[model samples]
Target: MSTFQLPSSTATTSTAYSSDEEDTLPYPGELSRSDFLAKDFNPEAYLSSLGRNRHQTLEDLRSDLRSRSQLLNQELLELVNGNYEEFLSLGADLHEGEERVEGVRVGVMGFGREVGGVGKVVREREREMEGLLVEKRRIGGEVGVGRALLEVDARLGEMEEGLGIIDRDEDEGDGFDEDDEEVGGEKGSSPVLRRLQRHTREFLLLTRMVERVGSSHPFLLAQQGRVDAIRKTLLLDLAAALRQAKAAKEADAMLGIVRMFSDLGAEGEGVRVLRGS
Candidate 1:
């Protein structure tokens, strides 16, 4: 029902009221909506506050309440009518709320699966990259080994070539120095024998390194025969040079040659040559 107000108490002229309409008589400007707004509002108490002035009969009050209720009902009906289309739309959407929620759930699940698949692919790629890195390191190590072996082989070849060149020069001159011991000066090495000393020392050191790698190392093993040939050729050259120095009576040259033998790890061979000479 629509809200109404009761008037406040004030001076009012007395008019004897019919018992049936005792508190229902009207008093002009004495009622307002604020009268009913009190926290403890009561219709009987509000009517009694009017004192002797009567407004109307009890049946009239009942009639006013009925009218207010009908008016409120009419207003509520109008409100519902005003947004009738929106109310229908809301009802329809609510009816389909479950299906919409299910669709959203399915979409989320599919996205999650895709994300998981991408993560799996990324992990697989990471593993592949790790394997590639390991392979790269192995290849790099092998390349380094190849370079070392190449260096060793090249050095050996150069030394062998030098030996041949020196041998050719040996028959060309006396190949002696002022330090030659044949003239009775203090013993000292000639230039020709000094070259041989260097050759023996370097070759022996290189060979020792190769041997330490183990005879079973495939690359060095394959080069073993060549290494042995170089060693044999070098020893022969040393022996011939020793013989030539003794024939020339060059003790200093011979001393240097024997030292070369020791450097080549062939001191036993030098001892035998000395015995024979």
Candidate 2:
């Protein structure tokens, strides 16, 4: 083996790499090459993505609004329909009650005397009054129906206003051009609109009917009152006859008068005839 000269430790230190070599390595805090490349990404592409997101959000909002609108409309319709039924029922009840009262009035009139003939006349008048009252009640019912129709119309208007707000929002999102105009114009004649229109027309007709009938009822009631007054007068006359007479003949005459008045009051035939007029 040939003996070689050993390198000294001082020589190895003298050939050391510079600090610049350390600078070439990436630091833990520094960005990677990929991160730097991604820094100048396209803003337009990002914005387009955001726009898509917004579109989806708007669509969701519209769907929610439409659902809410439908629910509200259904509830409103039910309420209006219920109100109409209640009013109609009330009016019928009133009519029936009035009829019963008139009958009772006639019965009371019949218990009087006949000698004066006043009792008979009063009973006839009461019968006429009952008929007039019936006619009046019928007319009143018509008026109530008309009022119910008007209420429904008013509710429809309110729902339309709410729908308008949603329409405005949609218009803002999608520019309303000629196509939109065409759609809107045609929508007015759609099946749903047609149905609503039919309902409105029916309501209007009912209202008009009520107005016509209402005008006649008060007059009829006035006539009825006159007949009632006559009945009351006859009742008074019979009562007087009952009190004044001691003789059986006088009592018999009074009884005949009472019977005549009772017959007249039976079903308010006179009142019915007046009402028919």
Clash count list over all predictions:
11, 7
Model 1 lDDT tens row, 110-203: 9999999999999999999999999999999888777778777776666656666324444454343434444322335565566566567668
The alpha-carbon lDDT assigned to residue 208 of candidate 2 equals 51
Q: What does candidate 1 score on TM?
A: 0.47
- What would the TM-scores of all predictions be? 0.47, 0.19
Q: How far is candidate 1 from the true structure (C-alpha RMSD, Å)?
A: 12.3
- Runs in model 2 deviating more than 4 A are 1-116, 165-277
* Candidate topping TM-score: 1
lDDT of 2 at 153: 43
- Compared with the true structure, the alpha-carbon lDDT of candidate 2 equals 0.48
- In terms of lDDT, which candidate is strongest? 1
Give model 2's TM-score versus the native structure: 0.19
Error of 1 at 153 (Å): 3.0
